[model samples]
Target: MNARLLILLPASLITAPALAQGGDSPLDPLFTCRDIADDGARLACLDAAVDALRSETESGEVVAVDREQIEAAEEATYGLTIPQFRLPGLSLPGGGEDAELAELESASASPQRVIVRDTNGQIESIEGLAVAEISENRSGDTIVRLANGQVWRQTDDTYVQLTRSRADTDYTATISNGALGSHFMRLDNGGRRFRVERVE
Candidate 1:
């Protein structure tokens, strides 16, 4: 284990800057130790790399996020336009002028409720979201709060009524990306569809 760790130093030193600038990954150094030929040198390298990584993490220069955290972030930011930028220690798949970091496929237990992304890796649709609460604004616009804490507001004048007495599970919806950056929410119970914009 020590030898394997030592091999990491030179590779990490060589790769860390490229990773920082090119949107690769600092975590690559953790995997580079296997290439070292000398045992003592490999152990030293790994030790140095590990120390650097620990320091970077403690100083907030690097952040570690698991799959669930990333998915939660994706869900929270869905239906919104996020400007492209690189974050340290968060390298995403794909490359090119128009390529985007592909989101990890959702591991939600609900078989039918999964986040779907478009060709550009933008969220295209989310299915089977339970309605947690519903209300109306002073302007008579309907406001819906989903179980995941997302808030959506009705944008059109269409009059539609949802049964308030039904269980929250009975008020499921599927929201999809609509034409020209618009969004539409379709209720599974009544098949009622309406234009909506995220309010929170």
Candidate 2:
């Protein structure tokens, strides 16, 4: 840590209890050591803090997930409503990645599928997902299982003409967010569209 960082630490370090409640960083104590005037005492505080952090991490109390892992998790649980939790030291994308992300604002076709985003920068839709399986429930509602193991069931009464003649890449699906937290799944063949909710 440099002198400038030490000088700015106190203003940003929140209370430990508040940080725990928010699932925020557990490095508050380390930053608090910035207030120590004696060099030896400050070093001791930092060493203790680091040891405590390591112990917590080893015990699984504190998790450390990188940006790529988080992004992959986000993609996996894209349409599902899950609890929001963040690990400490998780950083936002850098300026270089930001420039690449800016280019993704518009949907572009490439070898890899492009994720479309809305004006607010939220993921608008995910396309080119192969339909792994299609089944109907007792109520005759359409249930779709994608290659990624995401299971979605039809919520509305709209009848979706989906066939299992050719599974996998033969039928592609696009899932996009709709108004009022709703999601719509559209199929490539016949452009069949239906409202769906992720069941698993």
Tell me the tens digit of each residue's lDDT in model 2 across 108-198.
Answer: 2212444686674456888877666788899998898876666899999997875658664577788998988789998888756899999
Regions of candidate 1 where Cα sits further than 4 Å from its true position: 1-22, 30-41, 80-112, 118-122, 161-169
Per-residue lDDT for 1-200 in model 1, tens only? 23221211212222223322335466677568757898988898899889989887666456565434334445555665442222223442221121122221222323467678777555789988767777899999988777665679999987756766777556777899889878998877675689999876
Q: After superposition, how far is residue 116 of candidate 1 from its true place, in Å?
A: 3.1
TM-score of 1: 0.61
TM-score of each: 0.61, 0.64
